[model samples]
Target: SFDVGGKEAPKVQLTKDGKEVKFTSVEGTRHVYSIAEVKPEHQGVYKLTAKNKTSSEETTVTLNVTGMYIIQ
Candidate 1:
Protein backbone atom coordinates (compact mmCIF):
# COMPACT_ATOMS: atom_id res chain seq x y z
CA SER A 1 0.00 0.00 0.00
CA PHE A 2 1.12 3.50 -0.82
CA ASP A 3 1.67 5.65 2.24
CA VAL A 4 1.30 8.84 0.25
CA GLY A 5 -1.49 11.35 0.07
CA GLY A 6 -3.61 12.20 -2.96
CA LYS A 7 -3.66 8.47 -3.72
CA GLU A 8 -6.95 6.63 -3.47
CA ALA A 9 -7.05 2.85 -3.39
CA PRO A 10 -3.36 2.88 -2.72
CA LYS A 11 -3.51 -0.86 -2.36
CA VAL A 12 -5.86 -3.46 -3.75
CA GLN A 13 -6.13 -6.59 -1.68
CA LEU A 14 -7.67 -9.51 -3.58
CA THR A 15 -8.94 -12.56 -1.75
CA LYS A 16 -10.82 -15.70 -2.77
CA ASP A 17 -12.74 -17.50 -0.07
CA GLY A 18 -10.58 -15.87 2.56
CA LYS A 19 -7.44 -16.66 0.58
CA GLU A 20 -5.08 -14.40 -1.37
CA VAL A 21 -4.95 -14.18 -5.18
CA LYS A 22 -2.75 -12.76 -7.92
CA PHE A 23 -3.53 -9.38 -9.45
CA THR A 24 -2.01 -7.08 -12.05
CA SER A 25 -0.86 -3.62 -11.10
CA VAL A 26 -3.11 -0.78 -12.10
CA GLU A 27 -2.18 2.86 -12.67
CA GLY A 28 -0.92 4.40 -9.49
CA THR A 29 1.30 7.17 -8.18
CA ARG A 30 3.92 4.60 -7.18
CA HIS A 31 4.69 0.92 -7.33
CA VAL A 32 2.58 -1.54 -5.36
CA TYR A 33 3.11 -5.12 -4.23
CA SER A 34 0.86 -8.13 -4.76
CA ILE A 35 -1.14 -9.42 -1.84
CA ALA A 36 -0.65 -13.19 -2.29
CA GLU A 37 -1.94 -16.24 -4.15
CA VAL A 38 -5.30 -18.02 -4.00
CA LYS A 39 -5.09 -21.53 -2.68
CA PRO A 40 -6.76 -24.51 -4.36
CA GLU A 41 -9.42 -24.68 -1.65
CA HIS A 42 -10.18 -20.99 -2.18
CA GLN A 43 -13.15 -21.38 -4.43
CA GLY A 44 -16.07 -19.15 -3.54
CA VAL A 45 -16.70 -15.49 -2.93
CA TYR A 46 -13.91 -13.27 -4.09
CA LYS A 47 -13.56 -10.01 -2.22
CA LEU A 48 -11.50 -7.02 -3.23
CA THR A 49 -10.62 -4.34 -0.72
CA ALA A 50 -9.05 -1.11 -1.85
CA LYS A 51 -8.00 1.38 0.73
CA ASN A 52 -5.81 4.32 1.54
CA LYS A 53 -4.77 5.99 4.80
CA THR A 54 -8.16 7.66 4.88
CA SER A 55 -11.27 5.56 4.31
CA SER A 56 -11.68 2.18 2.68
CA GLU A 57 -14.08 0.59 0.19
CA GLU A 58 -14.97 -3.03 -0.49
CA THR A 59 -16.43 -5.21 -3.25
CA THR A 60 -17.19 -8.90 -3.64
CA VAL A 61 -17.72 -11.40 -6.48
CA THR A 62 -19.26 -14.83 -6.38
CA LEU A 63 -17.60 -17.96 -7.76
CA ASN A 64 -19.20 -21.35 -8.07
CA VAL A 65 -17.37 -24.64 -8.43
CA THR A 66 -18.64 -27.67 -10.26
CA GLY A 67 -17.72 -31.24 -11.00
CA MET A 68 -18.56 -33.70 -13.74
CA TYR A 69 -20.55 -36.85 -13.07
CA ILE A 70 -20.37 -38.92 -16.22
CA ILE A 71 -22.23 -42.16 -16.42
CA GLN A 72 -21.05 -45.15 -18.38
Candidate 2:
Protein backbone atom coordinates (compact mmCIF):
# COMPACT_ATOMS: atom_id res chain seq x y z
CA SER A 1 0.00 0.00 0.00
CA PHE A 2 1.10 3.58 -0.72
CA ASP A 3 -0.09 7.09 -0.08
CA VAL A 4 -0.12 9.60 -2.92
CA GLY A 5 -0.43 13.27 -2.13
CA GLY A 6 0.09 16.15 -4.53
CA LYS A 7 -1.71 18.83 -6.50
CA GLU A 8 -2.60 16.14 -9.01
CA ALA A 9 -2.87 12.38 -8.65
CA PRO A 10 0.01 10.62 -10.39
CA LYS A 11 -0.49 7.73 -12.76
CA VAL A 12 0.33 4.50 -10.93
CA GLN A 13 1.76 1.39 -12.56
CA LEU A 14 3.11 -1.99 -11.48
CA THR A 15 5.42 -4.40 -13.25
CA LYS A 16 7.04 -7.77 -12.71
CA ASP A 17 10.56 -8.43 -14.01
CA GLY A 18 10.19 -5.41 -16.30
CA LYS A 19 6.91 -6.67 -17.68
CA GLU A 20 3.57 -5.05 -16.97
CA VAL A 21 1.37 -7.01 -14.57
CA LYS A 22 -2.38 -6.82 -13.95
CA PHE A 23 -3.55 -6.56 -10.38
CA THR A 24 -6.60 -5.58 -8.34
CA SER A 25 -6.30 -2.05 -7.02
CA VAL A 26 -8.24 -0.48 -4.17
CA GLU A 27 -8.00 3.28 -4.45
CA GLY A 28 -9.03 5.70 -1.73
CA THR A 29 -7.04 7.49 0.91
CA ARG A 30 -4.44 4.79 0.23
CA HIS A 31 -3.62 2.62 -2.76
CA VAL A 32 -3.63 -1.12 -2.15
CA TYR A 33 -2.64 -3.83 -4.61
CA SER A 34 -3.94 -7.38 -4.39
CA ILE A 35 -3.15 -10.72 -5.91
CA ALA A 36 -5.78 -13.37 -5.14
CA GLU A 37 -3.34 -16.29 -5.30
CA VAL A 38 0.42 -16.68 -5.32
CA LYS A 39 2.34 -19.30 -7.24
CA PRO A 40 5.90 -20.08 -8.18
CA GLU A 41 5.53 -18.22 -11.46
CA HIS A 42 4.51 -15.12 -9.51
CA GLN A 43 7.91 -14.84 -7.88
CA GLY A 44 10.00 -12.08 -9.37
CA VAL A 45 11.23 -8.53 -8.95
CA TYR A 46 8.38 -6.06 -8.80
CA LYS A 47 8.48 -2.36 -9.51
CA LEU A 48 5.93 0.27 -8.60
CA THR A 49 6.00 3.65 -10.26
CA ALA A 50 4.03 6.85 -9.82
CA LYS A 51 4.37 9.52 -12.45
CA ASN A 52 2.97 12.99 -12.95
CA LYS A 53 3.66 15.88 -15.30
CA THR A 54 5.98 17.48 -12.77
CA SER A 55 7.96 14.52 -11.48
CA SER A 56 8.09 10.75 -10.98
CA GLU A 57 9.03 8.25 -8.30
CA GLU A 58 9.40 4.51 -8.06
CA THR A 59 10.29 1.60 -5.78
CA THR A 60 11.21 -2.04 -6.19
CA VAL A 61 10.75 -5.24 -4.22
CA THR A 62 11.98 -8.78 -4.78
CA LEU A 63 9.70 -11.77 -4.19
CA ASN A 64 11.09 -15.25 -3.70
CA VAL A 65 8.86 -18.32 -3.43
CA THR A 66 10.23 -21.66 -2.32
CA GLY A 67 8.73 -25.02 -3.05
CA MET A 68 6.71 -26.73 -0.32
CA TYR A 69 8.38 -29.68 1.40
CA ILE A 70 6.60 -32.78 2.63
CA ILE A 71 7.75 -35.36 5.13
CA GLN A 72 6.52 -38.91 5.77
**1-72 in candidate 2: lDDT tens per residue?**
777667788888789999987646646536676666788998999998889899999999899989889998
Model 1 lDDT tens row, 1-72? 332334454566777778877655545444344436544454578777767788777777775546657999
Model 1 spans with C-alpha error above 4 angstroms: 1-6, 24-42, 67-72
- Best model number under TM-score: 2
lDDT minimum window of 10 residues, candidate 2: 22-31
Q: Candidate 1, clashing residue pairs?
A: 20-37
Lowest summed lDDT across 10 adjacent residues in model 1 is found at 1-10
Clashes by residue pair, model 2: none
lDDT of each: 0.60, 0.81
